[model samples]
Target: MGPPALYALLMLAVPLATIFAYTFWTQDGLTIDRTLTFSNYREAFNDPLYRQLMLRSVWIAGAVTLATVMTAFPIAYFVSFHVPQRRKALWIFLITIPFWTSYLIRVFLWKVILGYNGVLNTTLLGLGIIDEPLSFILYNANAVVITLAHAFAPFAILPIFVALEKIDRSLLEASRDLGETHLTTFLRVTLPLAMPGIVAAALIVFIPTIGDYVTPRLVGGPDGLMIANMIQTQYLRLNDAPMGATLAVLAMAIVAVISALVFLASRLTARIWA
Candidate 1:
């Protein structure tokens, strides 16, 4: 590997090793007792609060992944099947325009739109649909899902679009020649062939959303707090690095299992396609 590669490995290795070591150690009054022990992991698994938050994070991440993939698939399908090839570039470009803005700005804008007396509430008020702002729309797990779905939309879209684009046009024609309807052809041919992309999209959205700190911090009040927020609290507010490291390791292990399942699903898709 080149110098940049070496540097990258160096940066990745050190912090990872440090965190792993911390998981084995215990925290004591603003100082870490560096002697190794399994107590952190023991406490993590035994604590109901830790278990609840971790599961909640994974569940919210799953919801975000599903929402983003469902929303993106239609747009990707439109671009791949309905739109003219010449206009496809413009459509993809438009999808990416949001990327030009900062993620923090996007989250803040969502807060504004979803907040009490924000656009959604004010519109509802002006239209006489409701006399008061809907308090349920923001500062909850629902808000986190909405924000993360919006944030990860493009990541889902691009992979799914690529998957749809690479599909052989002949397969659709072959199905049609056999007297298949458009819907049937899509269901039997296009959709199955596109499974790998959908899986990829799901993984992309699922992995990062679980680890996201900012969205949960902003939109997720007490109800919306995810595992990452808890880990952040442990490290920064609670001054418990060992516990934080333990949570981080546990998160990665869960995500690793998720990734393996997705990979197996993708391979199964490929075999079915073949």
Candidate 2:
């Protein structure tokens, strides 16, 4: 415990403390003033652009979490219940194949797929689906959602699969013997049991997605940018480290509150179902 705790404090705590400390200071040109002040936080809360970016980040992250979890649940159920025991490992291996490739490459491939003259549009045009390629799919919030949902699908699936596997098949058999329909059994038994994994998967997707700068940079154009993009701008482009730190702290606080609410809500729901 001593070594691990010391390591955690050094790696995680020190960096976080430094960021938080930076938020209280001021930066002018090349000089970072050590005088403690709340000006950065004041500006962050009062600025309209910051407000917009924060809301947008939360909305996009929530959307991605919903889409990923909803899609992953069915696949996890299939793999856990329908697949043979011996082939379960194979199915999981296949599901993780996406992780084998570079994340940047995957983002680029999505660009090619969603671009006006890219593969999707080319195929649609050849099929005469429409006269022109659609412009709404690329470089927008829609593209961000689609790309992220695909990228984080495996993260959502594996946890839910693990949860589902832990469920007792005998309980399901008993439910069926009591004359409940499959849907009812699933709703009353399977779903509640799987809620833990669903919550975990949602958190895993939501937290990182909110902080992701790369996907938005590539696929998310002007309208699709998130708070992370703004943070990057403040830190690197404008050389405003204090403001960047302030934004980072605010984002973390927001995530913490939202995650707590989500976890509590899930627990309540699970208890009711139980």
Clashes (backbone N, CA, C under 3 Å), per candidate, total 0, 0
195: Cα error in model 1, Å: 1.4
**Model 1 bad stretches (over 4 Å):** 2-5, 269-274
lDDT of 2 by residue, 1-274 (tens): 9999999999999999999999999997899999999999999999999999999999999999999999999999999999999999999999999999999999999999999999999999999997999999999999999999999999999999999999999999999999999999999999998899999999999999999999999999998999999999999999999999999999999999999999999988978887
Clashing pairs in 2: none
Positional deviation of residue 227's Cα in model 2 after best superposition, in angstroms: 0.5
Instruction: After superposing candidate 2 on the true structure, give the runs of residues whose Cα lies further than 4 Å from its correct spot.
Output: none
lDDT of 2 at 233: 99
Q: RMSD, each candidate, Å? A: 1.7, 0.8
TM-scores for candidates 1 onward, in order: 0.94, 0.99
lDDT (C-alpha) at residue 59 in model 1 = 93
